[model samples]
Target: MKRSKKRIIKTIVFEILLIISSLLIFAPILLAIIMSIQPPEFVFSYPPKFLPRGFFVQNYIDAFKIVPFARMILNSALISIFITLGKLFTGSLSGYAYANFSFKGSKITFYVLFATLFIPAEIVLIVPLFRIISRLGWTNTYWAMTIPFLASATNTFLMQQHFKTIPKEFEDAARIDGATPMQYFTKVLLPLSRPIIAGAAIINFTYAWNMYLWPMIVAMEDRMKTVQVAINMIMNAESSNNWGIIMAATVVALLPTLILFFALQDLFVKSLVGSGVKG
Candidate 1:
């Protein structure tokens, strides 16, 4: 009885500490959001106003006017969605095959793909990728933004680790019930793999949304550029005095990822543990 009580007390203490740490981490983000909506004078005020005063929404209006974020946001959404879905599909199939099947050169192929995680992307592929895209006439187009990153080694590694944790009996049972491999994969494994799927989607979506260097290189034209690139265009040495509009733009840019994470929060937490196990 005393041990149970001690454990409960320890758990409570841990949770309290965890909550405090989470709040501390989010403090800057919360402060930025508060500052974003405030009038310009209060932005540099001493002691700092931690709470929102009335709505000074002019910064947001000016942000849109100063930059064409509407089109950039839409482009980001479309590219991110495609990249996320493509990575999920490719990762799942490759992971499943590696975990379950044995075929000629399968081991070699898996090793090659896994090896890719180590090499710095810029050194090995950037020049060739640029040449290929230029030859394909995909520059300044959505295809240029989305296609190169469709396959991700990290996503495949996570899925492969997660799939290894499932029981072989599950596959045996499905086979005995006259189920084909594709049917078993689609109907049984994929359905139960929600945690990793959500994880991959969240991670890939955030990557695609926040991508900078490639988007800048590929989509040089204003209409084709992404939000991050657009943000850079909005802010430079000349715009140092207009920090309020920059903050407002940053806040608006953060909305989609924040909303997505909140919506899939449960799955996101599970993915952390799910990716680590191999049994």
Candidate 2:
């Protein structure tokens, strides 16, 4: 009975801690939502108000009117979709080759590729990458944003790990059926890789959607700017002190990634767990 009481007490404490941690993490988002709904006058009123005074939906409306929010949204969505598709295509093929084929210096090649994960592309390679893009006359085009990020070492590494975990029997069965390597890969391996693929897609989409620096550097034209870059346009066009409008734009910008994450969270979790194990 004493041990049972101790366990119950510990569980209660853990639950309380968990709830507190969750609230702390969620506080900023909750505050942002509250601020987005507040009036311009209430935004910075003395003592500050944490609750909504009224449903000021006009802030959301004003966010769109202040800039080409729709166009920027389209640009962001298309760019993110392209990057996600490209990453999946290249990552899967590269991972398949590295995981299944044994060639000269295969291990060395894979190690080199994996080493790129430690390198920060934004800081180190930005200048040279920009130079290359400029030389190609892609500085103001979608290609400038999409091509450089088409392949992700992290995604490739994850794919390779998950592929390695597949049982040899599947490979043997494919061989016995006289299936070509590509056929076997497409028909057999890919079907079983849905979880990881979904997870990787969401990750790539979120990264591309949230990218600000590269898009800002490459896209100077208003029409070419991504949503993240264009969010600043809200502040530039509106009064900088209007926190409600800024928060409204922020909430709008944050929704896509949040929705995608919530929808695919199960697949994402499965991929993380499955990718770490080897057969």
Candidate 3:
């Protein structure tokens, strides 16, 4: 009875801590949103009010006028979707092969991929990458936005580890049913791998959406810029005091990722656990 009481108290304490921590983490985002809807006068008032005086949603309307907000958002979405799909498709296939099949030079190839794990993408052959993209006439184009970001070594490794947790019996059963390799992968493996797929998709989409420097370097055209880069441009173009509109733009930029996360939170959490699972 005493132990049960202690356990209850501990669980309650943990829940309280979680709530507090969540609120603390979310406070900044809340501030941005609240400030976004507030009048400029109240937003910059002395002592900086946490609660807005009133909701002035015109901030959002005004933000669109300041920049090509809609176009940039579309650009961000396009790049993120394509990159996420590419990563998931390639990651799963490479992972399945590494986890299930024994092939010549496969180990060596995998080890070479790990070399990227140590070297940061920022430092890895930027000059050559730019030159190649420029040569292909992909600079400032959708191809430039999507091509350089299609695959990730981290995604490959993660999918490989996640695939190892599945039973080989599933593969054997599919084979016994006369399924071709592609049919087995698509029909059997893909369906069962939803959790990891969701996780990878979310992660990759977020990464692609938030990319700043690469888009800035590659997409010189204002219409082709990603949301992050566009936001910076917006801020630079706006008067210093016009933060409300900027905040509103930020809120708009955050919607896709926020919606994606809330919608797929269960799968996202599962992906975290999936990463830790080994053969």
Best by lDDT: 2
Candidate 1 deviant stretches above 4 angstroms: 1-9, 237-239, 276-279
Model 3: per-residue lDDT, tens digit, 156-210?
A: 8987887788888988999999998889888988888898899888889999999
Give the deviation of candidate 1 from the true structure as CA RMSD.
Answer: 1.9
Using TM-score as the yardstick, the better of models 2 and 3 is 3
Cα lDDT over the full model 3: 0.88
Q: Candidate 2, after superposition: displacement of residue 138 in Å?
A: 1.3
Model 1: per-residue lDDT, tens digit, 1-279?
999999999999999999999999998788778877888788888886777888888888888887688999898999999998889989898888888899999889889989999999977888899999999999999999888888888887788778888888899999999999999999889987998889788889999999998988888888898888878877863554676778888898899999999999899888787767655
Off by over 4 Å in 2: 1-5
* Clashing residue pair totals per candidate (backbone < 3 A): 0, 0, 0
lDDT of each: 0.86, 0.90, 0.88
Runs off by more than 4 Å, candidate 3: 277-279
RMSD of each: 1.9, 1.7, 1.4
Can you give the TM-score per candidate against the true fold?
0.93, 0.94, 0.96
Judge candidate 2 at residue 188 and give its lDDT: 91
